[model samples]
Target: MKHLILCCLLLCACVAAHAHKPSDSYLNLVVEGQSVTGQWDIALRDLDFAIGLDANGDAAITWGEVRARQSEIDAYAMARLQLQAGGKSCPAAVTEHLIDDHTDGAYVVLRFRALCADTVSELQARYALFFDIDPQHKGLLQLMYQGQSSTAIFSPDKATQQFKLTQPSRIRQFVDYGREGVWHIWIGFDHILFLLALLLPAVVVRREQTWQAVDAFKPALWSVLKIVTAFTLAHSITLTLATLGVISLPSRWVESTIAASVVVAALNNIYPLFRERRWVMAFLFGLIHGFGFASVLTDLGLPKSALVLALVGFNLGVETGQMAIVAVFLPLAFYLRRTTLYRRAILLGGSILIAILAAGWLVERVFDMKFLPF
Candidate 1:
C-alpha cells in the first residue's frame, strides 16, 4: 500500500506540475514622455472576473460587480501599486460616481463609477473583476479610445489590464491587466519548470566542459555561453514567430514533443547522439518552445494593430522568465564543477531524473494514458 501510494503521489505531482500556469500577474503601464514602460508582478486569487463594456465600448469589469467587490479589489491592488508607484501613491480629491451598466449576461449588469480628480494630474488604482467563472473560461474584452474601438480576447479565462484614469485630462494608470499579486507565482508552475529545464542543461553543460581541460576553464565557460546563446537565439526566433502567429502547431504536439526533448537530451548524455551538434537540437527544440509561446498569445486575443505592442510585451515577459531561469541555475553549475564527487552526483541524479520524466511523458503522450498526460 505504501508503494502504491508513492506511485499515486508521484503521478499527482506530475499532473500538478504540468497543470500549473505562469502566475496571476500585475501589470504597470507607465506612460512617460509619450512612451510606455511596463513592469509586472504576479499573484493568485480565489475570485472570478466580472466583464462589462466601457462607455467607449471597451470591455472591462462590470460596474455592478465593481461596486460589490470594490473594497476587495481595491484593497488587493493598493498595497502593490503603492510600492510600484513609489512617491506617487494613490490619487486624492477624486470623486466616485456610480453609473449603471449592462452586459451580455443578466448577472453582468451592475453599477460602478470611475474615481478620478482633474487636479490630481496622475491616478494610481487597482480593481478586481469577477465573472463568477474561472479565468480559464472563454473571455474577451473590448475598449473604445479616441472614438476607435479595440478588442482583446483572453480565452481560457484570465484577468486583464486596468484603465485607472480614462479621461484625456487625467491620462494615468496604476495597475495593469493580467497581473494580480503573489498568486501569479503559483499558477505559472509549468512556465517555471520549462525555463528551469532549459537553463539547467546549459549550466550543467558548461561545468562539464570546464573539467575537460585543466587550463581551459575560461574557455569552457565560453563554450557554455556559446551553447546558451545558441539556445536563446533559437528559442527567441521561434518565440517571435509563434507569437506573431506565423508558425502554428498543435499545443498537444508541442507539449508532447517538449517532453520528448528532455528524453533526447538525456539519451545524448549517455551516448553522443547529437554529437557536438547539440545546438541543432536546441534550435529544433526552440521551435517547439515558440509554439508554446504562441499558446499564450492565443490566450491574450490581442488585436492586429496592437499586435506588435502586445507581441513585444508578451515576448518581454518570456525573456525575463528565461533570464530568471539562467540566473538561478548558472552559478550553481560553477560550484558543482569544483568537486568531482558533486559532478558525478549531478550527472547521475540529473540523468536519472530526466530519463524518468521523459519515460513517463512518452508513455502518457504516445499512448494517451489515463495516469499522466504530458
Candidate 2:
C-alpha cells in the first residue's frame, strides 16, 4: 500500500510539472469615432508552429526571415481576429509590423487600423489565435474607449466578447483579476510543492538527525507563522517591483531558479541544513517566486488607473488561496504527526518525488525543451 501510494503521488507530480508554460498574446485596441487602431503581439514560437518562421532550419529566427513573411503573418493573425462595430464586420488593414521582447520570449507586433461603417458604441472582438494549435493559448485584451481602459482575457470558451464604449468599472476589473490570481496559484504546482516541503517539517522537531512529533501545537504554529510571513513579505516586494517595471530578470533564469528552489527545499527535508531556520529558506526562495507571479500580471498590461487596485486584489487572492492550502494541510499534518505515514510516506517519500519532479522542471526550463506532456 505504501509503495502504491508513493507511485501515485510521483505520477501526479510529474504531470503537474508540465502543466505550466508560456502561452499568451497581447491585444491593445483604441476606438476613435468610426475607426479602431490597435497593436497585436503574438508569440513567434506559436507562429513558427503555425507557419514556419525559421527559414534555413538553423533553429534561429531572424528579422530578415520574419520581415520576409510579413504578408503571411498579417493575413494569418487578422483572419483569426474579427473586429465588429455596430453589428458590422470591420476588416483590419495591416499598417506596420515589428518584433518586440516580452517576458516570455520574442513576439511579432502587428499594428493595424479598422474602419467601421457606422458609429462605434458596442465594440465586439472575436479572437481565435492559436486555438487550434495550442488550446492553452490566451489572448489578453486592453481596450481603450471614450478615454477609459478595460481589460479582458480571451480563451476558447470566452473567445467572442463585446465591450461598451464607456468608462470602465473598477469593481469588475478587481474581481476579474482577483479570480485570475487565485486560479494561478492553484495551477502553480511548483510553488505549491515548495511550500509543502517547507511545511512538512513544521509539525515535527529534529532530534539526533531524526524527525519527531511535537507535543504542543504552539511551537509548530509559531514556526508556520514565521515561515509563511517571511515568504509572503519577500514575494510581495518582488512581485510589486517587477510588475511596476522597477526590476526585471530573464524568464529563463527566473523559471530555472524557481525549480531549483523547490529541489533545494525538498532536499533539505531529508538532509538537515539550517535546521529550524526554514523561514530563511522560504524568504530567499519566495523572492524568485515573485517573478513567476509577475509574468501573468504584467502580460495583462493593466492601465495606470486600475494598476494599484488590480495588484492589491490579485495579491490578496493569492494569499487567500495559500491560506486555503495551509488550512487543509496543517490540520491533517498535525493530526498525523505521530504516525509513520506522516514521517516515512508523506515526508520522506513525498519529498523525494517532489525533488525528482523539480529537477525535471529545471532541465526543461534551462534547455527550453518540452520533456513532459501536461
| Total clashing pairs for each candidate | 35, 0
Deviation from native of the Cα of residue 97 in model 1, angstroms: 32
List ranges where model 2 is wrong by over 4 Å: 1-14, 19-21, 51-58, 64-72, 213-223, 246-253, 331-342, 360-374
Candidate 2 has what TM-score? 0.84
TM-score of each: 0.53, 0.84
Give the C-alpha lDDT of model 2: 0.85
Deviation of model 1 at 311, angstroms: 1.2
* Tens-place lDDT digits, model 2, residues 1-374: 65545434433533455535457899999999999999999989789989999999886789999999999999899999999988899988999888998876789999999999988998999999999988867888999887788998888888999888888889888987886677677678888888888988998999988999999888989999988998899899999999999999988899999999999999999998968999999999999999999987888887788899999878887888888777777776787788787788788888898898888888988998766654
Error of 2 at 208 (Å): 3.0
By lDDT, the best candidate is 2
Global Cα lDDT for candidate 1? 0.43
Model 1 per-residue lDDT tens digits across residues 43-82: 2122232222232433333555456664554444333232
Backbone steric clashes in candidate 1, count = 35
